[model samples]
Target: MKIIISEIPKEGLDVKLKEKVESENISSTVIAQLRIEKLEIEVIVSGDLAAEVKLECSRCLKDFNSKLMIPVNVVYHPVEELKGEDNYEVRHEELDMDFYSGEELNLSNLLKEQLMLNMPMKPLCADLCKGICPVCGKDLNIDKCTCTITKTDPRFEGLKKLLK
Candidate 1:
């Protein structure tokens, strides 16, 4: 969605965007609400974004679906006005402030950025997920493995003599 800064009225603008994003790593239909308020020469956009995404479990490597909701708040100022000594700093009231160079504001880029930021570093299907057995390549979650799970580091072997 695109928003023209000059077109905004005194009452502000309400925008709703819903569409499927094309990416192999992420599949989502983003439902976003954007409220644009013109404060002086700046455009303040604030809303909430929700989506259902497919994520791979880090432990079991299984695919699963999860829902996410992220709050969107940004202030766009002209790039020219934000350069040099007169550069704007993010004040206490405007923590999500940003600068825009173009005549139009592109919301798609912001939504994509937010989605990337909201992704989990380590996705897990379950907290207690028993991952695949490394020795025989068996799924430990489904069945018990006969393989002896041991960590025999060469450095730790010297410590065994002290116990003896």
Candidate 2:
């Protein structure tokens, strides 16, 4: 889904897409409703990207699906601005800025990036997941394990005596 920069009309372009993204990060089909506006050489792409992402629980290690709707608000600058060796600092507004080369703006890549950014760093099936038992290797949520576990750091031995 590439939007040619030169072909954009003065009234802007509206695009509605439902396609599976070809990326390692995204596993499910994505639906995007985007409005592309051109202000001089800069392109502003704003829309909502909807997708169902398959995620694995960090604690229980169970696979689950999460539905996400990420709001797209990105300003694309010419790739030539990224050239030269001049040192620069990025401002707060520039956080949403991206660089594009040539007349094509790949919306698929944009959707992939937005989806990745919106995904959780650590996915959990539930907040109070019991997780798997460390010693007996049994799912604590499903079954109980009779494994006496004691963990006391050597440095905390003196502190244990004080509590007693």
Candidate 3:
């Protein structure tokens, strides 16, 4: 979704879109609300994006729903503005800053970046989940296993005698 800078006129552009994003283990359906305020050749995008993603719980591997909110601010300039400089630093006034080769902005790429940034590294359903048992693969939280819990080290036998 690229918007031509010249087409924006003097006021600004307001846009809202609904899109779907697919990743390795998750698929997110998102709604993006955008407001573009132009400053000379540069445009500032300020908006809120919300999405619902399905993720697997790290402990029990159960699928769960996760909600994501992405707030975006980006400054875009014409490619001519960056002709002489190879390295440039983004300022506080700038967000999602980019220089375009043409008159249109590539909105799809920008949206993809925002979605990737919002994904969680490790998703958990609960903090204190008792994971599956290593031997029988039973859920430790639901039932007790018949396997005996024992310390196997012979070196600890002397310490065990001391306790007695």
- The number of the candidate with the highest lDDT is 2
Point out where model 3 deviates above 4 Å.
Answer: 23-26, 134-136, 141-164
TM-score: the better of candidates 1 and 2? 2
Best model per TM-score: 2
Clashing pairs in 2: none
The worst-scoring run of ten residues by lDDT in candidate 2 lies at 144-153
Instruction: Return whichever of 1 and 3 wins on TM-score.
Output: 1
Q: Per-residue lDDT of 1-164 in model 3, one digit per residue for the tens?
A: 77877888678889898877776755788889999888877877889889898877777677778888999887877778777888965664545676677778877666777888878887876677776777777777677564423434677868867998
Question: How many pairs of residues collide in model 3?
Answer: 2
Clashing pairs in 1: none
Candidate order by lDDT, decreasing, is 2, 1, 3
Error of 2 at 144 (Å): 2.6
Point out the worst 10-residue segment of candidate 1 by lDDT. 148-157
Best first by TM-score, ranked:
2, 1, 3
Per-prediction TM-score to the true structure, in the order listed: 0.79, 0.80, 0.74
Q: How many residue pairs clash (N, CA or C atoms closer than 3 angstroms) in each of the candidate models, in the order given? A: 0, 0, 2
